[model samples]
Target chain A: MTKPVLHLQPRVKTMISNATLEQASYEIMKKAAIDIPEDYLAGIKSVAAKESEQLSGFVIKTMINNYEAATEDRRPMCADTGLPRYYVKVGDHARFDGGFTGMERAMRSATARATIDVPLRPNRVHPLWRTDNNNNVGINSPEVEWSFEPDADWIDITTVHKGGLFGTDYRMLFPGDGIDGIKRFLLDTLISFGKRGLCCQPAIIGIGLGGSKDTCMQLGKQAACLRVVGNRNPDPKIAELEVELKDVANGIGMGPMGFVGSSMAVDLHIEVGHTHTGGMPISVHTFCLSSRRATARIHADDTIEYRTDPMWFTPYYRRETVIWENT
Target chain B: MLNKVNLDLPASPDDIAKLAIGSIVFLNGIVYTAREGVYNKVLVDGRELPDDLTSRSNVNFHCSPAASKNENGEFHIGGVTATASFRFSKYLAQWLDLTNTKIVIGKGGMPVNDYKNILAPRGAVYLTTVGYGTGALLGRGVQSVDAVHWLNELGIAQALWIFKVKNFGPFLVDSDLQGNSLFAQQGELINQNVEGLYDGLKEPALHRYGETGNRKDELM
Candidate 1:
């Protein structure tokens, strides 16, 4: 069967100049909001009892409190923004006034601006000195996972993924051969970190298997951005593995905040791609309780699209909020 | 009469480390607001803190969820999430001593070691509070943010304002001198013997001795 290409619309493409990028980031931070899915919340409530044998109510309330405080303060739910990544789908047939500056650049600009203006916590620092660049303007601020298709207008952007933290993502190291190695490594890395490393409760595991080294990581991040906090990968095999890992990792006894309980891990997602036989790579990224991603579909004529799933709803930012009505 | 205790927030790692094993203290009021990651970075970075933060608060670290106040004049704090103190305990003591600042209220107690012993003389203490109850603990009104600090390039975007709390916790004891950890000691004693179990191997003896040693005892 021939692979089918999806038509998409492209609009005016902006380079996202440093100033503009900075402004955009501030816009996202100050105004950017995420609508959490009810099902996701329900999942949290449901498994919460099983996860934490005791004080389940406390866990539920704490989770709610964390979300409430984050929303109220208008702060990035968690400090770690993970390896910044973006998966932008631009319609091939659609034409933007400025043309394409490549998805990576656009995302980088947005990330740079957000890092500074809205000033999402710059979790990206040197792996060595441990000094925080703080600007979110690291070697590579935001990674882009781009998929272009021929279409008329509109650019659909989804920032719904969770940030990937080292401790959480790199906990268990499962280094299987080829892609398997990467998969194993990601799992082992997460397990190694334990619950404390996992940080918050209701963690979502995003896995990218069978891709290039960098691609693997980006895929993992993109997977998170697309899925809700508590959903699983659609693939049966991957989903099963996710369930197995969930039980095994939780069994490690790294309960909430690594104290002692059953509720350490929550959701696990795995995204797989076919790679050359010899050099397959995989990466697993983790997002904590705070699922922080937003999406907007800007049409060629200036329209908007939003993603709504039972697990979450897109939050309306400042601009999206109606400021004034014209008679 | 309102008995209000006051303490200076911890400024240096030594300030954090020097907190004695057990001491009655009211962290007078100078400190920053931060949680584990921020705290970990601050200590590990070894970067000189902004002058104001260094001189102002006793210490700061991020606490999850939220901190709020209650109508009865108590703080309804939540998200007193447990942290891996074993990793930071020594680091904390060392910093407390250097800065001469003491006292931190969080969940769990500290490990017993030679370093913690120093706190005995320094009059430092590790205060324990209920974890998983963030709303209950932090209900006390927040006074103000002490300083603004950010790490990584993200700093350029927005400087996360670190706050200094007016009143943070009950300041209860989790660890004390003579190397006692209520959290650990209690668990250890329980696991070692089955004192609470009524239907143990000696149940038959107890049944035989029911009421008393004899019929009169049974009647009584």
Candidate 2:
């Protein structure tokens, strides 16, 4: 049997100019600073529906009002506009007019510009001298991380305004300890620090399992920034664990702002990878209810599309009812 | 029941003591903003209090707001960032004693014992506003912003701003001068809940993950 003859379409080289990249970066940063993503807003609304506690409901309502006011006025949602972080996915086939360094330079300039235009709070302080750079431009001012995608013709950039609130914690568990150990570690951390303004309730919890410490941490951060609320891991066991952890966290009743409420964490996102047989590293990164993130794409033609959802994680179907165990 | 009281600056000990945990206040008059650096400079570094901030009924906001200048070069405040209060609780206890500050406003509740020992004796209350509701707090609550100090030195994070506010809260009185803390009580209840959940899960956790001989240590 002869293989069918296949005709390959000619590849079109996309020319992404530094100016276009800079402008796109600026637009994304501005939008991220001012706007909370639609999915997050929807999650807030959903949780608001379930909030029976008077103060929690009032806080949630106020959050919705604040979101509206911030968007309308083009003001930042939170005063802590936070440290700017950019995650860039470069297509293997895409070519930059000025190369990668040029792209980095463009991102830096765009960040500086947005710092002034969006008037983002200058949260970056000199690490050693403790001096303030009014423009928020210093060594590695806007942290940029890159990844390459094969056979892709467009670049996707997601900007995150990492606030000062959410604190990250990591632990190395013995492989023999198993998944139950991971659960215990997570619960212990959340119970102790979650209410201490670290893991803000009604938060988006991201858990990274089974990697080196750095890899786990990076994956956890990505999970927190890019995962959509109400979405879970694609793996069945991990997805079930996500639901169970969500139930357990919310059951703590730390509530909104750590007051009293039924709604604590709105969603849990877990990313797992194989690790050395001896070590199972776990890292937890939380995004507060305000979860500030935005994404933009630059096509081969240089046409830009701004997106509310970054669309990083796999989506899972929601369970209609969560079974509660009698304690 | 939550009370809607309008508190004036240099609030008297009686006023601070009268407030109860869970009471809502609509603060009027002037409040000064302060964060870590300001606390360090004043309390730790032994800097003198500026005349502008010397009111006996002082309300210090634990905020580092995002403020910007308009085309006219007039500064307009964006809103306040709610930081963790416990980070500054010990310093605040000292500052309150030194300054006789009446009210402290921030996000998250401070240590329970601090409210009982330091704050109650000094005649102060800790109020909590909705976290991340900066725009709502600025647009609807704060009346005006003025006297931005340390804008160039500390950046917006530590720059002290004098905010004139009217009905500026729906602030929950998390800590009152009567040695009561709403959040502290909530924390205790949460602790109980966590303990209960952990206790229930212990047997299952041990059964699933525990070694045959050393079950208890792994659970711990």
Output the number of the lDDT-best candidate.
2
Give per-model CA RMSD: 16.0, 8.1
Per-residue lDDT tens digits for candidate 1, residues A65-99, read 55555456544333333345454565555544434
**C-alpha local distance difference test of each model:** 0.46, 0.75
- The residue-by-residue lDDT of candidate 2 on A206-306, one tens digit each, is 88887788889988888778888877776788889988888877777777777678777778888876788888888887787668898889998888999
Q: Evaluated with DockQ, which candidate comes out highest? A: 2
Q: Model 1: which docking level applies?
A: incorrect
Specify the poorest-scoring 10-residue window by lDDT in model 1 chain B.
B198-207
Candidate 1, B-chain TM: 0.54
Query: What DockQ results do all the predictions give, each relative to the true complex?
Result: 0.05, 0.34
Q: What is the interface RMSD of candidate 2, in Å?
A: 3.3
State which docking tier applies to candidate 2.
Answer: acceptable
